[model samples]
Target: MKVLVLGSGGREHALCWKLAQSPLIEKVFCAPGNAGIAEDAECIPISVNDFEALADFAQKEDIAFTIVGPEDPLAKGIVDFFEDRGLKIFGPSAKAAQIEGSKVFAKKIMAKYGIPTASFEIFDDPQKAIEYVEKKGAPIVVKADGLAAGKGVIVCDTVEEAKEAINKIMVEKAFGEAGNRVVIEECLFGEEASFMILTDGKTLFVLPSSQDHKPLLDGDKGPNTGGMGAYSPAPVVTPELEEKIMKTIMEPLIKGLAQEGIPYKGVLYAGLMIVDGEPYVLEFNCRFGDPECQPLMMRIKSDLAEIIMAALEGKLAEKKLELREEAAVCVVMASKGYPGKYEKGKVIKGLEEVGRMPGVKVFHAGTAKKDGEFVTNGGRVLGVTALGKDIPEAIDKAYEAVEKISWEGVHFRRDIGRKAIKHLPPKVLIFAGSKSDLPIIFKTEEVFQEFLVPYRIVVASSYRNPDKVRSLVKNAEEKGIKVLVAGAGLAAHLAGAIASETILPVIGLPLATGTLGGIDALLSTAQMPPGVPVATVTINGSINAAILAIQMLALSDERLQKRLLKYKKQLAEN
Candidate 1:
C-alpha cells in the first residue's frame, strides 16, 4: 500500500522512515519533508497547510492511506477534509483536536470527567488575568489557551513575571491569534513526563514513557524551545505511576470524548506532571511529540505502518506494538538565536560520517537540499537520535554522533540525559558566575573533598543565563541535593536567584575586585529580596560557603554532624 504523510519536521521524518520499512507499505510520500526525509520517502513540494493541494495530489497519485503529523493542520480539520474526499487519514478530527488546539476546551473535558489535573481558571481579558496573578502570588503558571507550537506555557516565578506573561499572551499577542485567551493555574511541583498512546476511540496502545527537555540550555534553564532533547522510557514514570495515568487520565479522556460524540482516533499525547507519585495532566497533544517521536521511532521493534492501519481499520484491540529494550535518546541541534530570530542557509557538513556510526539516525528538522548540499533552513536543524543498552549509554552515543555533524551557528544542550544517571546522588551543588571565580571554586572543592562530601560544581551566570541557574536549582532538588553554594563578584545575584527558585539552603560566597572590593556583592547576597533569603558569607569566603553548606546538610546527617564538629574543634584549637 502507498502512504502519504503530512509534516516537515523530525516527527514526520520518523513516521515516513518507519512506514517505509513495513512489509505492507510499497511506497511512502511526504507532502513537505526536510533534507533527511527525502532519503526515506518521495518528497513533494506541497505544504501541509494546503489541504486542497494535498487532497488533489493524493487523488492524482492514488495514495492508499494518509497520515497527519503536525497539530496545526489537524486542528484545522484536515482529517474531515480528507474523509469528505473519501481518503483515509490518521489523526483526530477538528472538534476532537481541541484537546490540544485549545487549552480551555481540554481543561473543561478533564474537569468534567474527573481527570486529575491542576486547578485552573480561564481568562480572555488581560486586566482580569493580571488581577488574578496579583491575588494568587508568584510561582504560578500562565498559559496561552490556543496552539503556540509548544511555547505557550510560561512557568512564572513572580507575580510580576506572571503579569508580564498575561500581557505577552493576551495583550501583545506573542503567539498570534492563539494567545487571545489564557489559562492561569497553580504551579504543580514535580518532574514532568510525556505519555503517548494509540487509540481508535476505544482500545489504547501505550507507547514507552518519555521525558522531553524543553529549555534551550542545559541544566533545565533557558527560554522554552520546541524541545531541546528527549529520552525514553522516562526514569520518573514507574510502572505504578503508568497504571495510575492509564486509569485516571487516558481511559477517562477517551471515554469522555466518546460520550461527547467526538470519535477520537490517532495518537493522544498527555503532558503529565508526576506529583507525589501521582500523575496530573499538564496538557494534551492530539498527535505525537516531535523529539519524543524521534526517540520512540528509534526504539520500535514493530512495523509502524501495520499498527496505524489497525487503528484506522478498527482492529486496534487485535494489534500489538513492540519496543526494543534499549533506551533511546534524541538531541536537537539548532541554529543559534533559536526560539527567536536566527540565520539560516548555513552549509551543514559531516552527515555521511555520522551515518556510519551504529544505531544513530540524524533526523533532520530544518534543512533544505540546495545545489547538492544540505543547508540549514530553520531554527532546529537536526535531531541526532541513538539507541543503547541504557539511558547513559544512549546519551553518550547520541552525543558522540552529534559531535560529527555541524552547521554554522549550531548549538545543542550538553546535558541531554543527565537526569537518568543512577550512580550516586550529590548532596550539595556549587555554582560560580564565571570560570574567573575558580579561586573561590577551588576552595569550595577543597572543603568538599576533605569532608568526603559528594558535590557537583557548575559555572553559570545568574544574570547572563538566569534560566540555567533556575534549571540547576530544579535539577539539584531532583538529584537529592541538600544545599547549594554560589560564588560571584559584582552585582552578585547568583545566590539570591538560586535561593528564590528552590527551597534548599543556599550559601553565598562573595568575591571582590576593583575599588569597592566585594562589599557590593556582599550586600547583595546578605540583603536578598524580602521573601527570598540567602545565607551570605564574607568576601572571598568560598571555604565558609562550603562549610555552611555542609552544616546545613549536617542538620539531618549525624555522620556529617560529627565530622563537622571535629573540623570545627580542630580550627578552634589551631
Candidate 2:
C-alpha cells in the first residue's frame, strides 16, 4: 500500500516520517515537502490546495490513503474532493472544517451544544464590533471570523488595542477576506492545552494532551505566531481535566456536528483553556497542530498507517493508541521576524550533526535544498524535537539540539516547559475600614496563610478616605488580585466601595467590635445598591470571609481549587 501526506510543514514531515516506519505501508510520499522531509519520503511537487490535481495524482500514483496535514486544505474541501472520486483520505470535510475555518461557526456550534466556551458575539459591521468592545470593556479578545494563518486572534489588554484589531481586520482588511467578519469575546484566564483526537464520526481515540506556546518570546510575551514550541503530556491537563474536556467540549462537538449531518471523520483538535480544574474550548482545528504534531509524532509508539486506516474504516473502537512513556518536546526555529514580514532564504546548517544525536529529529517546515545546502524558505524553518524521561529533560535535550543548528537570523522561546517547573503563588487582598478592625483582619490573614493563599492587608476607610480606598482597589486590580476582603465595624461600606472599583469578587466582614451588637455593620454591608453587590458574612466572621474570598479566586485557579476541595472534605469528615 502507498500513502500520500499533504502540506509541507513540520507536521506533514512528522506524519510522513512516522508513516514510512509502518510495516503495513509499502511507500510514503509528501506533497511539496521541505528539505528535511525529502530525507524521509518521496517529495512530490504539487500544491495541497490544488484539489483536482491532488485527486488526479493520488489516483495516478495508486496512493492507498491520503492524509491532509494543514487546516487550509481541509477548509478548502480536500476531503470531499478526494472522497467523491472514491479516493480514501483522512481529514474533516469542508462543512465540518468550518468549525476551525470560521470562528462564528465554531461559536454557534458550541453555543448550541452547551459546550463551555468564552461568551462571544459575532459582528460583520466594523462599527458594531467597536461598539461591543466599548460596552464589554478592556481585557477582551478580537478575532477574524475566517482563518488568518493562526494570526487572526488578538488578545487585547486595552479597549484601544481591541479597536485597533477590529480596524485592522475589518476596516483595513489586514487578513484579506478572512477579516471581513469578526468575533469578539471575553478574555478567559488560565493555562492552555491542545486536546486532539482521531474520530470516525462517532467513536474517538484520544491523544495525549499537549501545550503549545503561541507567543514569540519567552515568558509568554510578544505577538502570537503559528507556534513557537510545544510539549506532550502537559501537566495542566490532569486526568479529571481530560474527562471534563471530553464530556463537555469534544464529545458534544462531535455529536453535534454529526447531528447536523456533517459527521466529522478526521482528527478533531480542541484548543482548550483549563480554568479552575474546568475546561473551556478556545477554538477548534480540523487537523493536527504543527509544533504539537512534531512532539506527538515523536512520542507515539503505534503504527501511524494502521491507526489512520482504522479511523477511516469506522473501526476506531477496536484500536487503542499506545504512547512512549518518555515525554517529547519540539522547539521551532524560525527567521528573525515571524507572524509578520521577515527575511527568508538564509542558509541553515548543522542539521545532519543534530539528527545524529539520540532522541532527536529535525522536521523542516520552510527550507529548500539550494546548491546542495538547506536554506530557509519560510518564517518557521525547522522543528527540533527531542524525547526524555521527563519534561525538563526533554526540554533540555530539545534546547541542546536547538543550540547545535544556526542560521542568519534565528529566534525561539527559551521557556518552553517552564510552567511545569514552578507554580505561581495565589494572591488575595484585604481592606479594613479602621485600625480597630485589625484584630479580626489579622485573623483573616491567618486563615489565608493556613490555606497558602497569599494576601495583603490595608487600612482604608471607605467614607473617610474614599479617594484612598478607590486608589487601593484600582492598584490591587492592576496587580492581578483575584479577590478582595473588606472588614468594617460601624455602617460598614468598605466592601461595596472596593467592589465598585473593580470586577474582582469582594467579601465583606462585619466586625463585632462596635456598639449595637454589630447589627449596624451587618445591615449596612448586606444591603448594597442594586448594581453594586457584596457577599456579606456573619458578624466577626473573618475566617469565613477569607474562605469565601479564596473560593471566588479558585474559580480560575487549579491548585487553589484542589486545596480548597481538600479543606472542605476535611470539614465534612470532621
Candidate 3:
C-alpha cells in the first residue's frame, strides 16, 4: 500500500525509484527527497533526522509502511520510536544498529562469536591510541570507532602516518565526536567483496556479491569516498565463497544480535575480505550501500515492497528472494575535486539519452531542480547502471551509457573487470609430474600472468594414478580447454597419458629429477604413437611450455599478440 522512505541521498532516491515500480505499492513518499527522486514520488519537507516530525507526518498521512534509508536515523532509535507507536517500519532497533554505528561494538561482537576478522585494539584515550601506533609499525588500519560518513578509516603505510591519523581523529577532533575513539587493526591483504543479505533477525536471504571502488581516483590511488562506483556478481565471490562468508560472518552476527535482544531486521551489509579461499569480516553497514544499491536494485528480480514487508513482519523465512542471472555494473559520476572542495549547481546534460540506451538506467544521487532544469547538488551526482547476459556485455553497455552522459570533471575506472577476466574459462591447463618440476612451470605461470591469459597449473603423479591422468585429460576435453602442458622427470608418461586420452595439443616439459638426468623423460615425452602427437621442450624448460600454450591461444586472439609483445619489451628492459 502506501510506502514512506526516509533519506535524502542517491541511495534513498534509488529505493524510492524501485519502490514506486512495485505493483504492491499504491503510493510512495520521500522525506526531503532530491530533484531526481521527485520524478517518481511525492517529496516531503521534513528532515530525515527529525524523529518526532517524521513520526507525526507518517501518522497524519496514515502511511501504511515506512522504510528508513540512512543509518543515522536507525542509530538514533527512529525505528524503535515508530514501532512503539504501532507504526510499521523496516529497520533495526538502536541496539542492533550498533553493528554499524560503533566499529568497536561490532568488533567485540565478532570476537565474542569467533567470527573471522582482522585483529584489532580499541582505544578511547588519544594518548593510548598514539601508544598503540608506536608499538605497532606502519601498514596498519586506523578507523574511527563511530560513523564518519565512510571517510574515517585510514590505511597508514608508516608509523608516523598512523600516529598522525590517530592524533587528528582523537585529539584534533577531525571527525568530531565520531572520532572520540579509534581502532587500530592489523592489515590484511586480499580482494575485498561486499555481501549483503535481507534478514528478519532469524532467517537470512543472501544477495549477489558486489565489488565497490572505494578510492576517489582511478588505480585506487586517492582518498576514500562513499564508493565511487560498484559492479555486481564479482567473480571473486564465487558461489563457494559466498557460502563460506555466510557461515563465518553473516550467521554469527545475526545470531549474536538476537542473543543481545536487538532482534535485527532489514539489510545486513557485510564488507568481506577473501584471502586464499577463506573469508573475513571487514566491517558492517546498517543499510544498503549507495552506489552498490543502485546496481543491485537493477539486478534484483523480486518486488522491493514485498521484501521489506516480509522482513518487517518476520515472514522472511516464507518469502523467496530471487535475482537475475545476468551481471550488473554501476558507474558513478561525481563533481570535479570530489571528496574535497567542489562547486555544485552546474547543469547536467544527456541523462535522458543515457537512460534510453539499451539495458541502462540512471539513478540520481545528488541533484536539485532549479527553473525546471536538473543541476548537481552533491559530490556524487548519478549512478549509471546497465545489465547484460555477462560481465563483458555489461561493461560495454555501461560504458556506452557513460559516453552519452557528460558533466565537467567526471571520472571513472576504465579497467573495472581487469582482474575478473582471469577467471574466464582458461585457455590452457599445464600438468607437471612432481613439485620438483615447479621451476619449469614457474615460467608458464609468468607467461600467463604477463599476457593475462586464463590458465591453471596442476601437479600430477603420472605413474601413481594412470587412470586419474586419463580422467583429467577426458575432463579437460569435455570442458574445452584448448591446450595442455605435461612435465615429468623419469619415465615421463605424462605426455603419453594426455595424448592417449585427447586429440588436443600437448606440450611436454622434461625435468632433470631422475638419475639419468631427464634423458629418459625427454626421450619418452618426445616419442609418441603415429597418430598421436606430443610437442617436446628442452630439458627442465618450463618457459617453452608456456610459449606453446600462448601460441595456441594466440591463434584465435589477435589482441593477445599485442599484449605479449608489450610484455616481451618490459621483460627485455628488466
Candidate 4:
C-alpha cells in the first residue's frame, strides 16, 4: 500500500518516518516536504491545501491513505474534499475542525456539553471587546478566532495590555482576516499537558500523554512560536486524571458533535491544564502538534499504518495500540529571533553525526536542499529527539544531540522537560451486556466508589456494540484494567467474549432475570471452555463482583489491601 502525508514540517517528517516503517506500506510520499523528510519518503511539490491537485496525485500514485499533519489543510476541509472524490483520508471535516480553527466555536460546544473550560465571550466589535475585557479585568486571554499559526493568542497582565492586543488583532489586523472575529476568554494558569487520541467517531484509542513548550524563549518567558520542545508520558496526567479528562472532555465532545449531525472521523487533541489535580481545557487542535508529534512518534511501538487504516475503515474499535516504556523528548532547533524575524538560508552542519547517535533522531522542519547541503528554510528548523529510561535522561540525550548540530542563528530551550518529572494512576472496567441489565448492574459503581477504586462503566452488548467490546477487551491490559466485571442475564456471552480478547482477569455476575430466574445465565457464565475461564458469582451478584475486582487489585496495592482487610473485619463484627 502507498501513503501520502500532507504538510512540510517536523511533524510531517516524523509521520513519514513512522509510516515508512510499516510492512504493509510499500511506498510513502510527502507533499512539499522539507529537505529532512525527503530522505524518508518521496517528496512531491504539490501544496497541502491544493485539494484538486493532491487528489489527482493520490489517484495517479494509487495512494491508499493520506495522512494530514497540519491544521491549515484540515481546517480547509481537506478530508471532506478527498472523501468527495472517493479517496481515503485522515483528519476531521471543516465543520468539526472548527473546534481548533475557531476558539469561539470550541467554547460554544464546551458550554453546550458542560465540558470544563474557561469562561468567555466572543466579539467582533473592537470597542465592545475592550469594554468586556476591562469589565472582566486583567490576566485574561485574547485570541483570534481564525488560524494564526500559533501566534494569535495573547495573555495580558493588565487592562492596557488587553486593549493593545484587541487593537492589534481586530483593528490593526496583526493576523490579517483571521482577526476579523476574536474569542476573549478567562486566562487559566496551570501545568499544561497534551492528550491526543485516534477515533472512528464512535470509539477511541488514547495515546501517551505529552507536554509541549510553546514559548519562544527559555523559562517560558517570551512570545509563542509553533512549539519549542516536548516530552511524552507527562507525569502530571495521572491515570485518574486521564480518566476524568476522557469522561468529561473527550467523550462528551465527541458525542455532542455526533449529536449535532457532525461525526468526527480522525484525531482529536485536547490541550489540558492540571489545576489543583483537576483537568481543564486550555485549547484544542485539529491535527497532530508539531514538536509534540516528533517525540510521540518516536515512542510509539506499533505499526503506524495499521492504526490509521483501521480508523479510515471504521475498524478503529478493533485495533490495539502499543507504545514503548522508555520516555522520549524532542528539543526544537529554530532560526534566530523566531516568533518574529530571522534569517533562513544558513547551512546546518553535523546532522549525519547526530543522526548516527544511539536512540537519537533528527527531524527536519524548515530546510531546503541547496546543492548537496541542507540549509534552514523556516522559523522552526528541526526536532532533535532521543529516548531514555526517563524524562531527565531523555532530556539530557536530546540536548547532547542538539549540541552536535549547529547553524549561524540556531536557538533552543534548554529547560524542555524540566517541569514534567513529577509523579502517575490505575483503572478497572465494568461491562454490562445489555441496557435491561444496567439497572442492577450499576450497583457495582457504588461499591467501587465506597472502596475508592477508580472504574469505568460501559454498556457494550454482544449484539449491539460487539466491535466496541472487542476493542475494550483487546486493549484492557495495556490500559491498566486490573479486573473486568461483566454482567448479563440470558445467554451471558459478555464474559466469554472479554476473556477471548485479553489475559486480564474477568468476573461474571449473572442477573436474576428471565424464565429460569438467572439459572440459565449462571450456567452460561460458568460453562466457558477450559482455556477461557470466567469467575462466576451468585445471581444478582453485582456487589460481590465489585468485591472480587477489589480483591484482585489489592494484590498489588498495600493501601487497598489494608482497606479491604478493614472492610472484611467490619463485616464479621457486624
Candidate 5:
C-alpha cells in the first residue's frame, strides 16, 4: 500500500521514515517534504494548500491513504475533501480540527464539557481584548483565536505585556487573520507537557508523553518559535498523570466532540499545564508536534502503518503501539535569527558524520540539496534526535550529534530536557498475566502498603497482548519502574518475558493452578535463557515477591532498608 504524508517539516520526515518501514507499505511519499524527507520517501512539490491537486495526485498514484503532519490542511477540511472524493485519508474533519484551528472553538468545547482549562473570555475588538487583559491583571495569557503555527499564544507577566500582546495579535495582526479575535485567559502556571494520542473516534491509544521547549533562547528566555527541542517520555507526566489526562481531558474532549456531532480521529495533542499533579489543557493540536514527533518516532517499535490502519478501520481497540524502552530527545537547530528575520540557503556541514552515529538521526525541517551539498531552506533547519538509557543520556547524545553538524548561523537550545533529570524517582511495577491473578497481586499489594513502598500493578497477557507486555517491560527502567514482579499460572512464561526485555531485576511468583499442582508454573518461572534470570518464588508465594521487591529497592534506600528490617523483626516475633 502506498501512503502519502502532508507537510514539509521534521514531523513529516519522521512520519515518512517510520511509515516506509511497514511491510504492508509498498511506498511512502511526502508532498512538499524537506531534504531529509527526500532520503526517506519520494518528495512531491505540491503545496499542501492545494487540496484539489493533492487529491488528484493521490488518486493517480493509487495512494492507499494519507496522513497529515501539520494543522494547516486539516483546518482547511482536507480530510473531508479526500473522503468526499472517495479517497482514504487520516486526520480529523475540518469541524473537529477546529479544536486546534480556533482557540475559541477549543475553549467552548472545554467549557461545555467541563474539561479542565483556564478561565477565559473571547474578544474580536482589539480594545475589548486589552480591556479584558487589564481587568484580569498580570500573569494572564493572550491567544489568537486561530492557528499561528505554535506561536499564537503569549504568557504575559505584566499587564503592560498583556496589553501589548493583545495589540500585537489583534491590532497589528501579528498572526494574520488568526488575530481578528483573541482569547484572554487567566494564566495556568505549571510545567508544560505535550501529550498525544491516536483515536478511532471511540478507542484512544496514547503516544508517549513529551515536553517541548518553545522559547527561542536558552533557559526559556525568548520569543516562541515552532519548537526549540523536545524529549519523551516527560517525567512530569507520570503514569498516574497520564491516566488522569486521559480521564479528565482526552476522554471528555472526545466524548464532547461526539456529542456535538463531530467524530474526532487521528492525533489529538493536548498542550498541557500540569499544576500540583493536576493536568489542565492549555491548547490542542490536531497533528503530531514537530520536534516531539522526531524523538517519539525513534522510540516506536510498532509498525506505523498497522497502527494507522487500525485507527482508520475502527480496529484500534485491539491494537497497541510499542515503543523502545530507552528515552528519546530531539534538539532543533535553527537559523541564527530564527522566529525573526533570517537568511536561508547557507551551506550546512557534518551531516554524514552525524548520520554514522548510532541511536541518532538528523531530520531536516528546512534544507535543500545544492550541488550535492545540503543548505538551509527554512527558519528551523534540522532536528537532531537520539535515544539513550534515560533522558539525561539522550540529551547528551543529541547535543553531541548537534555539535558535529553546523551552518554559518546555526542555533539551538542548550538545556533541552534539563528540568526532568532531577525529578525521576525509580518505581516498582507488578505485572499479572491476567486479571484473574489479581488475588495473587493483592497479597503483594498488601506488603507494599504496609511498608509504604511506592509501586504500580499492571495486568497484561504475555500470550494475547505480547507486544503490550514487552513494551511495558522494556520501558520499565526509563519510566522509573526499576523492579518488576510477574505473576502467572500454567506454563508461566510471563515472568521470563519480562526478564528478557530489560536487565532490571524480575521477581516471579508462580500461581497454584491447573492439574500439575502448580509445579509447571514454578519450573517455568525459574527457567530462563543463558544469562537471563528470574527470582522465582514458590507456588502462590506472593508475599515473598513483595518482600523481595522491597529488598531490592532497599539496596539503595537506607530508610527502606531500616523499615524492612523492622518488618522482618515483627514477622520473626510473630
Candidate 6:
C-alpha cells in the first residue's frame, strides 16, 4: 500500500525508512523529506503545515495510508481533515492532540481523569503567573501553554527567576505566539522517563520505557534542547512499575480522551516523573518523541506498517505488538553551542565508518547533502544508535560509534548507564537453609545476571550444616561484603547463622513451598534474636535481596551513590 508520511524531521525520516522496508508497503512518500529520507522514500515538496495541500496530495496520489509525524499537523487537525475526505490516517485528532498542544489542557484533563500529575495552575496574564510563582515558592516549573519545540519549559530555582520566566513568556513573547498562555506547575523531583503507547482510542499497546537527555550539556546541565540523546528499555521502569503506569497513566488518559468524543489514535507519548513507585504525567506529546523514537524503533520487533494500520483500522486491541528483549541507546551529535547559538554547515566525517559497526545505525537529524558531502543543517545533528543484549553492551556499542562519527562541537553524556552498572554485581551471600534450599538458591543464581548484578552464590545448610554456613559467612566478611542476603524457607536458620557470624547487614529472602506458603519462613527471617539485626524481604524476594545489596554498596561508592540517587529520583518521578 502507498504510505504518506507528513513531516521533515529525523523522526519522520526514521518512520519513512521503517515503512519502506515493509513488504506490505508498495510505496513510501515523505513531505519535504531530508537528505537521509530521500535515500529511502520519495520526498514531496508540500510543507507539513499545509493541511489543504497535504490532503490534496494524498488524494491525488491515492495514498492508502497517511501517518502524521509531527505534532503541529496533528494539533491543526490534519488527521481529522484527511478522515473527512475518506482517507485513512494514523494520528490523533486535533481535540486529542491538545494533550500535547496545550499544557493547560493536558493538565486539566489529567486532573479531571484522576491521572497522577504534578499540581498545576494555568495563566494567561503575567501578574497571575508571578502570583502563582510567589505562592508556590522557588524551584517550580514554568511552561508555555503551546508548543515551543521542547524548549518552552523552565525549571526556576527561585521565585525571582520564576517571575522573570513568566515575564519572558507572557510579556516579552520570548516564544512568540506560542507563549500566549503559561502553565505553572509544582516541581516534582524524580527520575524522568518517556513512555509511548500505540492506541486505537480504546486498547493500548505499550512500548519500552526510555530516558531522554533533555539538557544540552552533560550531567543534566544547561538549557533543554529537543532531546540531545536517548536510551530505551530503561531499568528505571521495572516490570511491576510499568504495570502501574499502564493502569494509572496510559489507561486513564486513553479512556478519558475517548470519553471526550475524541477517539485518540496513533502514538500517545507520556513524559512521566516516577516518584515513590508512582508515575505522574510530566507532559504529553501527541506524536513520537525525537531521539526516543530512534532507539524505540530499533528495539521494536513488530512491523511498523502493520501496527499503524491496526490502529487506523480500530483493531489495535486484538493485536499484540512485540518488542525485542535487547536494549537500545542513541547519542546525539550537535553543532557548536546548541540550544542557543550554534555554527552550522560543518562537514561531518567518519559516518560510513561508524555505520559499519555491528548493531550501529547513524540516523541523520540535522543534516543535508551540500556540494556532494553531508553537512550539518540544524542544532542537533546525528543520532548514533546501537542495540545490544543489555544496557551496558548497548552503551559500549553506542559510544564506540560516537567516537567514530565527528562534527564540530559534538558533546554527549559519559555516565549514561553509570548507575545501572552497580546492579551488575550481586552482593548477596545466599546461605542455603539445610540441603533443601540448595536447588532454589542455585535457580535464583541462574537468573542473577538478568537483574544485572554479580552474585557470590553459595550453598551452605545452616541448620544441618552449621559448620559450612559459619565458614561461608566468615569468608564473606573477608571478601568485603557489606550486606548478607540469605535465601531460606521453612524454619529458616540461614539468616540467623549469617547474622550471628558477622557484624555486616543481613537480609533474608523467604522461599514459598511449605504448609504456610512461606509465612513461617518470613516470620523466622523477620524475628531475629536480640542484637542480631537482619532485614527481611518478602517470600521469593531474591530480586529485592540483590537490590538491597546494591543500595548498601551505594553508601560508600560515589558512582553507586549517584545511581541510587537517580533510581530514587526516578521512583519519585513515577
Which of the numbered candidates is closest to the native, going by highest lDDT? 5
Error of 3 at 208 (Å): 2.1
Per-residue CA lDDT of model 4 for 430-459, tens digit only, reads: 898887888988898777766656677788
Question: Candidate 4: where are CA atoms >4 Å away?
Answer: 424-574
Each candidate: what lDDT? 0.89, 0.88, 0.84, 0.89, 0.90, 0.81
Error of 1 at 320 (Å): 1.4
Clashing residue pairs, backbone N/CA/C < 3 A, model 3: none
Candidate 1 per-residue lDDT over residues 1-574, each given as its tens digit:
8999999999999899889889998889998987889999999999999999999999998988899989999999999999999998999999999999999999999999999999999998899899988999989999999999899999999999998899889888989999889999999998889999998877899999999999999778989889999999887887888898999999999999999999899999999988878899999999999899999999899998888888889999998889899999999999999999999889999999998999999898999988999999998899999998777568768887888888778999998876655222578888989988887688887787666566788999988999888888998887888988888989888998899889888888889954789998898889987878888889998888888888887887665686788798998999
Model 2: residues with Cα > 4 Å off, grouped in runs: 423-574
- Tell how far residue 21 is off in model 5, in angstroms: 1.0
Task: Write down the TM-score of every candidate.
Answer: 0.75, 0.75, 0.80, 0.74, 0.75, 0.76
* Model 5 alpha-carbon miss at residue 202, Å: 1.1
**Residue 169 CA displacement from its true place in model 2, Å:** 0.3
For model 4, the run of ten residues with the poorest summed lDDT: 418-427
lDDT of predicted model 6: 0.81
Q: Evaluate model 1: give its TM-score.
A: 0.75
lDDT of 4 at 132: 97
Clash pairs (backbone) in predicted model 1: 221-467
Winner by TM-score: 3
RMSD of model 1 against the true structure: 12.9
- Record all residue pairs in model 5 with backbone atoms less than 3 Å apart, i.e. clashing: none
lDDT of 3 by residue, 1-574 (tens): 7889998787887788889999988889999888888888999989989988988989988898998888888898998999888899988889999999999999999999999999999999978888887888879999999888888999898999898899889898988999988889998888887889988887898977888888877667778888877888888888888888888888888888778877888888988887887988889998998788877888888998888888877888888878898888888888988888889888888888775687788888889988888899988888888897766557657776888888677766665544555666777888877787887677777667655567877888778877777787889977768999998888888887888788889888888885999899999999887988889999988777787778777787664565567667887999
Question: How displaced is residue 442 in candidate 3, in Å?
Answer: 12
lDDT of 1: 0.89
Cα displacement (Å) at residue 208, model 4: 0.6
